[model samples]
Target: MGRTILLKMLLFFGIVFAFCTCGKRPVADLPTFHVDVKQRDSASCFFSGYSYVMLETNMECLLTDVDKIKVDSEKIAVLDRERILFYEHDTGRFIGKIDRLGKGHNEYLSIDDFIVRDSLVYVLSAMQHAILVYDVYGHPIKEIQLDAFYKHFDFWDEHRVFLSSDFGNDTYYNFVLFDLRTGTVLRRFDEFSQNESVFFNSFSSFSGRNNKELYVIHPFDYTIYTLTDTVFVPYCRFDFNTEETFDMGKSFAELSDQTRNKSVVKYLGNLIESDSVMYLTFDLFDSHGIGTYLYKRCGQQSYLIRINEDFISDFPYLSSPKGIHGNTLISVLSASTILDIEETYGLSFFRKKGLNKEDNHVIFFHKLE
Candidate 1:
């Protein structure tokens, strides 16, 4: 290895050794919330009503789908594949888009995730091992290259951000606290487990955006950890009320294909958190059962919301949401579906000017009472 690479490896091991005391809690020690998946309710049973904002779809700002969404007080950013499309928060007025999908110094091949910290937009291009920073408009500021491979990331603080790969499939560190300005490794979590293999990597491990806290979860592990200044501490656990159990301590690579295909898998996760509740969407690797549950942040009271009953029936892709405006949660649907909804429910809505459902997507903002 090169001298610089060798030095980084040593630094990583040293950091892991130093922070060993921020230990993982025993499974029995974590607090658990019980969810009754069978007792399901339609979206209307929980939400009083919803309002929508149709994204302006002219020739300039056309998007196929919303891969991910980040909503702030005044702006909304949508990752439509490799491009980041921006829109007004109140009205879906088209803002400019950031399309730097080239093999140049300021370009990236793919965008795994993106976040608006303040005035700047930080786009994560995992395959390029770089995060291209830009102003609110699509103008390029600079690129921060990285040594480690991280598919998803969220800010831990101003100076540091948390980067994580798969839960147990990575050959080296699964999680790292990385410095944004200097590109230094502040800390590394659980280094060198099994061989490198990608498994269940599509899930968004980080949530708790409203509170500015980091809450992360994996598909196989039941525990959720809150990131502190030092290490991750157990925050809560999902008690699915099943009597069956498996080895939560081992890496996913240690398990066979049957175990992986048969086990529980969390899709597009995030464990969406508001001030009062944490929303979880999960499945058992089969079509027979897929459920969503809302658990209280301070208490154990929970309710299961049934998908396929309404609103395109997407568990997390309504579509790929992080738009926390208030008590309101957001989802996406085809604009043409509105006609179907009105006809099926025998209800009428005030249709907008350009309400063509041929290829347009509408944003639904709903509040749970």
Candidate 2:
């Protein structure tokens, strides 16, 4: 009986030891790949430009240009001056004007940003601090008013919307999520402060395949946040202030320091997501010139893609760019040019002409090559 009892005790100890050893094993590191491709220019595309100026009380809201217009499939619907124009994506034929608000209404309802999902159009009106929902036929459905000042917004899913507020004197601005059907505040996240400095810029969010995980980007500091279990969590943080990481050499750092003052970093782009990858864009300016970086998030680490100066020099009006068809990058070229290009797998450029002569030139980049 004593021998049998001792054997049982030894077996229990063995099982516990095995469990602890397996549990303590570290997880395998994520894999990474680097691609070296020579830059090449492709085709040209065009888009229309609108100009407007609003006077309210003693303040003036001037819209120097309406750029970065996107198409739902092949149809172009964007505001030009005081008129909202629609065109056939293939033939570039003028379809009709969508919105014809009076000067008073236009001044108050000027579109700050817009997003298209299915048959619904979501436009952000910064002056009103509200979002106007409209159908494809240009009919208003409903509106959502946010308590804080918002700069841009994006749809998380069919029922949820994410809004980004402008960073005031504070280093970071708050991001809020709202329910579209009920217009209820669902969740909010604050920026992580660095040395009492909160990094503020437009934020980017994309969900995984099963929507099990959500990814967010802080454009100012090159930080990436992931939302898990309905809570915002820091997945990885990158410091672009060093050489080993930034790789711009001395010129890049000097330029970053100089432009750090007059240059304002804005998140005027869209987040592109695939089954396994995500991409985002952010603009950085230094005294030398302005530069835009395309940041890619694979599994854990992030990769940087720098926009060449030659491309920017050729197309000066290209600012904030977004994704179309989940793999292409679309942006406005000059005041009148529209650019469409593939951003995933590889990079390519395409351009089209806008409606009028002032809006006739468009340029875009793709990854067809």
Candidate 3:
């Protein structure tokens, strides 16, 4: 009986020791890839743009200055100025528009940002500190008022929303979780660290969204983090060699004011992750160059995707790119760019049902191989 008790005590102690050791294990280092723009330009996978027809109505609305875009399985959404226009994904048919911009009750004075999730559209209004919910047909469902004003926001789930602002200071948190139903602050993470040089030109925060994870990159710091429950854990690191990477010691505002182009670093833009690869697009201001990178996880290899033709030449980089269903990137093209594509490459691939020069726009779809 004494030998049996001794054996059980030894087993219990061994289990406790193993659990303590496992809890103290350090985080593994994230993978880094060095992208050489000049070498990648020659060896790249090229993709061309094809035009899609837009169904016209008596509204006579033209999407001139589009700001943001979001995609789902069946529909594509574009935030054109103050309106959120929905289009059929298979065909670029104008399905509906959400343009309830007013100062009255349940009406928004200005729209800050929007997201389409689960057949519902959530529009954030900074002016009124409210979120207006709508259906796919542009019908009003409900509105939720937030206590604080946020410049940028995205819906995380049915009841939670992630919010951010450029005007954040030491007192203001960089990102926060707000309850959608009651407009109450649930949790806050990451402090705002931008100094005075952030006023000349501002860029949106770098964020990527998949079905299961939400990733965000710090502006001043080059660290990418993923949201896990209530905290953001570091996910990956971007290395641009010794000379090309941004100086983390100085603020971006300071770098912009002091240096012309010599000390300025490459700006990180939109990032999206797939099953086997990660897609990121950035630009170089000193040399006026834009590059899209794909990092494959199988062999841990990264490559720069150079669109050979002037597919998106009108914009500096892929502006407001959204990862649609089937792991594809989709964006809306202006009417002028559609004409340019038609002139350069013949219209055999395009279906010009009711598309005209100044009235209709094209939908650009890019599939990864």
Which candidate has the highest TM-score of all?
1
Candidate 3 differs from the real structure by a C-alpha RMSD in angstroms, to one decimal, of 6.0
Residue 344's lDDT within candidate 1 is: 68
Better of 1 and 3 by lDDT: 1
Rank list by lDDT:
1, 3, 2
Clashing residue pair totals per candidate (backbone < 3 A) = 2, 28, 1
Candidate 2 lDDT at 152 equals 61
Model 2 lDDT at residue 143: 71
lDDT (Cα, tens digit) per residue for candidate 3, span 1-369? 999999999999999988655423233656555555444532224233332335343354567777766777678788777888887777667788888788865567887777888888888886677788998677889988876666677667778888875444343676788888777878887665543325222245536776766777655445567763466666766655423444456766665554455523345555667566676655444344433344333346656644432344422223334334344555566656655566775552333654456666665655544
lDDT string for model 1 (189-238, tens) is 65555554555534666755446457776556667777754766677787
Model 3 misplacement above 4 A: 1-28, 41-59, 136-139, 166-171, 193-206, 241-246, 258-266, 286-298, 307-326, 345-348, 351-355
10 residues in a row with least lDDT, candidate 3: 42-51
lDDT of 3 at 109: 85
Cα shift from native, residue 6, model 1 (Å): 38
Per-model lDDT: 0.66, 0.48, 0.61
Q: Which candidate number has the best lDDT?
A: 1
